[model samples]
Target: MEYISFYNGNEMPIVGLGTFRVENNDECKASVKHAIESGFTHIDTAMIYENEDKVGEGIAEGLAATGLKRSDLFITSKLWLADYGRENVAEAYETSLKKLGLDYLDLYLMHWPGTDEAVMIDTWQGMEDLYKENKVKNIGVSNFNVEHLEALLAQVSIKPVINQVEFHPYLLQASLNRYLDVQNIHMESWSPLMNAQILEDETVKAIAKEVGKSPAQVIIRWNIEHGVVVIPKSVTPSRIEENLEVFDFSLTAEQIERLDKLNENSRIGPDPVEYSGH
Candidate 1:
């Protein structure tokens, strides 16, 4: 498993399993358990998904099944929009921790920027308190653009360790990534697989043929090579394992250029331009 060292010196897996729509308790538990069994140590979930408890059950079963310790896995959860204020954030984070049944979260992030600046600042303060109290190892933000990042940067003492967004071949986000790179802030991809359409993309397929790898592997490898932490979710066991089979090969400069041309500046989720934070 490849890793990316954060600005604070903590190591994060380059690839992780995303549990966004894995709501069914049995299915979620099985998917995570299968992932762990297949050597995946990182798990991503959020309170907005309302599946943290099920995720916890899966993690517990996976640990028991594999005999892996808590420190071996990178477990991340996010605070929802409804719990955006300072007071509410503190309580909400505690609730998530309890539901996850973990002593300390590996990483906790603001699910969204939210509509209130004061609330966002307060939430960061709460995260700072949690870090000081040894409740969370790192703190970050999600779905925040450059402006939002600037806003958070101006007020917080501890800079956000990461910013996760919906990134894929269609939405390249090169400019945003450059800005984040300047700040030494790591970027994570939520929908890294882009609904598996890369498999059907002519450019990606061409690269796959040239590289003797699948298109899925090519795009995923591109993400890792570009230094982005990606979580490509899959309920199928074969797809889950195939997603991790990207470590052995590398993409050529020309192939990367071709793939870069595939970006359409499209977003599968909410538009950040009109986004009033959340």
Candidate 2:
């Protein structure tokens, strides 16, 4: 698997399995287990996903099935909004760790940027403390825009290693990506396929046809080629295996530009600026 090396010398898989709406415990467990068994070394989930117990089961089973050590995998979980208070952060993280049945997480992220600046800063402080104490290997935030990133950066000591956001062919956020590049913060893609919406896009279909790959593969590869880490979620066994098969082929410069120009700045999740919380 291809990896993006961070500034601190750690590495993350370019492709990972995202667990967002996999609410059903059994299915979530099976999907994660299947993913690991199919050679996936990276797994992304959050406390709000509400299926950490099952994800833990899958991880246990997957490791046992593949004889892979815990250190061989990169596991990430997030701190939810309700758990944003300075004192609440550790308890929330421990709860997730308990449910995930893991001793520690490879990466931890603030799930969103609420409107409260102080709360956000406090939450980040907790994350930084965790990182400094070696409770987590890395810390980041999801759905944070430039303004929020600036606010958090000004208040925190260790800068967030990554900022994950909704990105796909339809919503490129080129300017934000450039800003992330300048700030030395890695930009990771959450809904890289736009909930499979990009899979049916005409340009994506054409490119897939030209490359003899599925539209999903084409879009996923496009995200990776853009230097964005992508986590394409799938519960289906075939698609889980298919999503990871993007390492062999390469998208041409022209094809990459074609996909790049498809961005309309659309979003499927809440805008960071306006979203207060759930």
Candidate 3:
């Protein structure tokens, strides 16, 4: 497995399993178990996913099935909007940790940048506290744009190690990607596959045929080659295994340029600026 070393010197698997809509306990548990059993070392979940307990169950079962210790895996969860305040953020982390049956998280992120900048600043303080207290190994933000990142960086003592966003061939986010690169912040892709839309694209399909790989593999390899961490979610055991098989092949510079040109600035998820949930 490939790893991305954070600014703080912590390394996480470049590829991970994302649990977003895996709503039910039984399915979530089984999916996580299957992922680990299929050789996945990193798992991503969130407080909003409402399956932390089941995810915890899956982690327990996966560890038991694979004989892997807690330290052998990298687990991540996010703080929901409702838990944005300084008082509530740490509590939210504790609740997620308790639900996941773990004492410390490998990484914890602010799910979104709330509308109010001051509130987000306080939220960062809470996350910083968690890091100081040894409750989380690293802290980051998801769905944040350039303005949000600048605000946070200007006031905070610790810089976020990552800025996970809705990145794919369709929504390239080139400007944000460049900003993050300059800041030395890693970019993580939440919907790296664009919910299967990219699989049907003519260009992607043509590239897949040329490379003798699946469309999913081609897209995933593109993200990896761009130095972006990708978490492609799948409940199907075969796909969970297949998503990890992207390490074998390499995409040529021309092919990568072709894929890069497919960007249209489209988004499958909510826009961070207008999204004001709490």
Candidate 4:
């Protein structure tokens, strides 16, 4: 597995298992456990996903099965908009940590940008406090654009370590990518496969054929080569292992450009900036 060192000197696995809509309790637990056994130490979950308890159970089982310590894994969870407040930030973090059966999270992210920047900034201060207290090792934001990041950075002492967003061959997120690179903040691609929508694209299929990999692998490699973290969600054990099989090969520059040129600036998830829940 490849790791990208955040500006804070903390390292996160470039690839992780995204538990978004994995609602079945047994499947979620099994998926988490299987992922760890499959050499994926980084598991991403969120409060809104409503599967943290099962994920935590899987972590326990994976640990007992492999004799791996808690520190051996890089676990991440997110804070939803409903739970974004100065006092509520820590409250939500505690609740998520408890649900995950973890003392501290490797990374914690503000799940969305929401509509109001003030609440976002206030919520970020709480995260900064958690970092100071060592309750969470890393803090970041998801679905945030450059404007949101700039406002939050102006009010807070620590900038976010990364920004998680919907990025795929269809939604390349180029402008945001350039800004993040300049800020020394890392970028993570959620729904990197575009909900499996891009897998059938001719360009994607063509490259997959050329590399002797699945279309999913080609899309993932595209994100990896772009220097962005990729989290492709799956519950099937075989698919889970297949997703992790991306590190063995690489996409050439020409192929990456072909995938990049397929961009339509589309999204399969909610827009954090326009989301009104917060």
Candidate 5:
């Protein structure tokens, strides 16, 4: 698996397993376990997902199956929008820790900017405190645009190391990438396959055929090659393995350019800036 070294001194796997709508307990646990067994060390979860306990259970099962220690994995979780605020941030972090049954998280992110301004700043400060306390290795924001990032950077003592956004071939954010690159903030992509939209594109399909790889694999490979971290969710065991099978081949510049033409500025997930009114 490819990796991105965040500015905050942590390395995140380029490809992780996203657990957004994976609601079933047994299936989520089994899929997470299968993903870990399939060479996925990065497991992304959220407090709002209401599956941290199951995610923890799956991780334990995977560790038992593989005999790997906690240090061998990079786990990430997000604080929900409703839980944003200084005091609640601490409470949320503790709650997530209790649910995950872990001493520390590899990374913790703000699920959204949240509604309350004081609460947002408070939560950010709390996250900074958590970082200083070494409760979390790194802190970040999700669904944040350039303006939102700039605003946070202006106020907070600790800058977010990464920004997880809804990036994919169909929703290419060149401007966002350029800005984040200038700030040395790494970008993580959610809904990486563009909700399987790229799979239906003629150019992507042709390229996938030429490369002897599936369309999903090609899109993921493209994202990694472009230095964007991605998390593709799947409950099927076979697809989980397939998602991890992207490291074998490299996308050529010409192929990447061809795929770049597929961008229509389509976003498969919520827009962070508008959603949070930031």
Candidate 6:
């Protein structure tokens, strides 16, 4: 698996399994197991997903099935909005650890920027505490815009290593990407396939035909070529295996540009700024 090194020198697989709405415990566990058995070493889950327990089960089974140890895997989870506070964030981290049946996480993130700036800053402080205590290897924020990042960076001592967000050909987020680049923050793409919407796009289809790859593979290759970590979710065994097969061929610069022009600032998930769910 290809890896991206964080600012602190920690590295993770460029591709991972995203567990967003895989809510059924049995299904979630089986999907994770299948992904691991198919050569996935990275797994992404969040407290809000409410599937950590099952994800943990899949990790245990996958380790046993593959004879791989826990240290060989890169596991990540997030702190939900409801857990935003100096004290509650740490507790939330512990709760995720317990649920995932792990001693420490490879990376942990604030799920969102919250409703205002003070809450985000306070929550970031809590994340900093986790980093200092060695509870997690790296810390970051998800769904943060440039404004939120600037405000957090102005107040915090340590910079976030990543800013996970919804990204795809449809939602290019070019300006945000540029800002993240200047800040030395890596971007991780969730919904990289636009929840299957991009698979049927004419441009994507033509590229897939030209490259002799699936449209999904073309989109994933685009993210990797642009230096973004991508986690595409799937529960089917065949698709779980297929998603990891983008290393063979690459998109040419011309092809990449065509894919780039497909951007319309579209989003398949909720907008972070307006989302008020706890």
User: lDDT by residue for model 3 over 163-200, one digit each (tens)?
Assistant: 99999999899999999999999999988998988899
- TM-score preference between candidates 3 and 4, better one: 3
The estimated TM-scores of all candidates read: 0.96, 0.98, 0.98, 0.98, 0.96, 0.98
Q: lDDT value for candidate 1?
A: 0.87
Q: Judge candidate 4 at residue 78 and give its lDDT.
A: 96
Tens digits of per-residue lDDT for model 6 on 1-278? 89999889999899999999899479999999999999999999999999999999999999999999999999999998888888898899999999999999999999888778888898899999999998889999899999899899999998999999999998899999999999889999999988888899999999999999999999999999999999999999999999999999999999999999988998888898887664
Error of 2 at 151 (Å): 1.3
How much lDDT does each candidate structure score?
A: 0.87, 0.91, 0.93, 0.91, 0.87, 0.93
Model 6 gets an lDDT of: 0.93
Clash count for each candidate, listed in order shown: 0, 0, 0, 0, 1, 0
Poorest lDDT segment (10 consecutive residues) of candidate 4: 269-278
Candidate 5, residues 1-278, lDDT tens digits: the string is: 77889876678888999998888499999999999999999999998889999898899999989888999899999988777767777789989988887888999999887555566777889899899988889999888777777778888898888888888878889999999999999999888877776689889899999999999999889989889988998889999999999988999999999888878887777666557633
Residue-wise C-alpha lDDT for candidate 4, range 1-278, written one tens digit per residue: 99999999999999999999988498899999999999889999999999999999999998988889999899999999899888899889999999999999999999888888888898899889999998889999999998998898778899899999989988888899999999999999998888788888999999999999999998888888998999999999999999999989998889999989998877788776688753
Give the clashing residue pairs of candidate 4, or none: none
lDDT: worst 10-residue window of model 1: 269-278
TM-score of 3: 0.98
Q: What's the CA RMSD for each of the models?
A: 1.5, 0.8, 0.9, 1.0, 1.7, 0.9
